[model samples]
Target: MTPTVISPASPVELLHYMITYQRYPTTLLICSSDDEFRAAIAEELKGQIPEEQLQQEPDEFGEVIIDHPLAALPIFRRVVARHLRVLFVPSVIHLRAILSVFSQADSPIPPPPEEDSENTKQGARPRPPSLFAYGFLELHRDSSEWSAQGLSSSASMFVAAARRSGFNPVMVEPKAAGGLANFEHVLREHAPILSGGARRDEGWQGRTVEVRRVFDRWFRFQTGQWDIKWPEDNAS
Candidate 1:
């Protein structure tokens, strides 16, 4: 199928195209920041998300600069990719996160504006020494070595890399939020296609596998094909 970029004057038009499109399979709406998207979606599609569920607070990294349209793109891509369909629209953050290699001690991307206060309170956190820094710092410290294949133990590293690139990742939740285990549960339920990691020496491929599964499950859950273990994952 052809991959053509669609541009419209507003987020409503974007969502309209996404909901109506038959060929694309999955649609992603991305913007530079989240507030802009949230405002647009609220204006255009008032009830897409409930008022109480939206995350009003910024993440420690200040990545909340992304809006709903842009945030939705990665989730949409993850879902569509799992269905073996080409992703529609492009989220700068999602694209950069998945495409870039991991490194430890990589410099931290500027925090989102909403997170400045948190940063001040936390003081200056040293940047990871490598591209896999997030992984090393959050998920797997010792095993933080960058592996271009498999689901490397450092999911945080991938998230951090995206943050470093000035992109906010819109996953169901932060691993610290107990989302990883929830994601694991979702993966087990769906019976997703998992590549053999150690055998193929494709740890990075495994990472993509996990990401795709999470997206697939999330989309399915949204469409009523599966039940979400926790509603919070779908809320914000």
Candidate 2:
């Protein structure tokens, strides 16, 4: 399944998302490459999000579905372990998404699970939502949308993880603006999460960032509330 990706208006727009929606410390920044784009993004996010919170891409960039199952990948395992929301920022990175029934993608691999027959019965693992979760999946795309993250590749696993986290993600993008120019002057400004006046998209004209929740009504992971209303906002 394709990962739900978002190409925001600017880097400031992305920072605004983190400040407004992802106020908690449950988010994780997973860089896909150490190239200029990733480096620029990491550099820009310094004062806004802690350095430790970010996880740069490892050497195993394009070697997914190579040595181990997608479930066994370190990043995937970490997402399962920490219940952390993932922001898979990447540039020129691709991974093997699906393995055909006969194609030799991974050798000595076990047979894919077959559809159970009418009488065949097997034990199935229980799927339950996390008791304590406050995170969601978000991808801040640069100019080229779906170019970084594997759009039609291995992304279903991530969606499953988010569902277990007890909430859904609302992807924000540059609806009217042309596209993001670069990753500079990110986290330049921040508004209190609780405070709101004009909508964030109303007057953001330049380097200054006035971040707030992109949507007036959305699912809040921290409180498990969907209709989160700000007094100053939606008063009219």
Candidate 3:
């Protein structure tokens, strides 16, 4: 029988989506050596979506999967400039698109190695749409005693960990440009809950974060409500 997992919070929901979508837009899984934890995550995911959609990869990256339908979705890729190493910017979707584009390359793309604690400090980078759209999936041990306070505290830590994982971790607030702030605010507000400790920081501090909001029009277009209107982004 397929395992069933329950997620009482939105963070879990986001993780389910991220894990499920891995098979689609791009099939890449990032997991640790813990099988039980991975199984728990997969079970929790079964609660969110159907079992047929998930496929696992048995290799160094561990049991990973991508949604079959999203196989046709185009991906984007961006290089992490050494100067912007610690910044968590851009949405995960945007990163996914970027990575998908880069995955086309025949070479094996490498993830950033674990950062040395002594050389780290707070930093900022441009936020992309994917990160905002997907939010983040922070895994924590069930044995760890976590309260509401811990969830809030861990948000920052998860972002930091994402940076170490080679993704931008932008500090989004309730208000910011490109609807970036709004998207993150909504995601976190609607984010699924999970076990964790206190957050490392309260919020972010940055003046110039190139953020863009995905307006209702984009959704409308996505849903076939109207034709798609893409902005002329020279940066890409």
Q: TM-score of every model?
A: 0.22, 0.27, 0.23
Q: For candidate 3, lDDT tens digit of each residue in 57-127?
A: 55466744545332211211211211111112233333333434332123243333533332364563322
For candidate 2, the lDDT comes to 0.30
What TM-score does structure 3 among the candidates reach? Answer: 0.23
lDDT winner between 2 and 3, please give it. 2
Q: Write one digit per residue (lDDT tens) for candidate 1, span 11-53.
A: 4443333344322212132423445445544554434556665
- Which TM-score value belongs to model 1? 0.22
Lowest lDDT block of 10, candidate 1: 132-141
Q: Candidate 1 at residue 52, lDDT?
A: 61
Which regions of candidate 2 fall more than 4 Å away from where they truly are? 1-7, 28-150, 170-236
On the 0 to 100 scale, the lDDT of residue 123 in model 2 is 60
Q: Which candidate tops TM-score?
A: 2
Q: How does model 3 fare in lDDT?
A: 0.30
Q: Relative to the unseen true structure, what is the C-alpha lDDT of residue 178 in candidate 3, on a scale of 0 to 100?
A: 16
For residues 86-123, could you state the per-residue lDDT of candidate 2 as single tens digits?
44444323221211121222223222244224125566
In model 3, the Cα lDDT at residue 135 comes to: 23
Which number leads on lDDT? Answer: 1
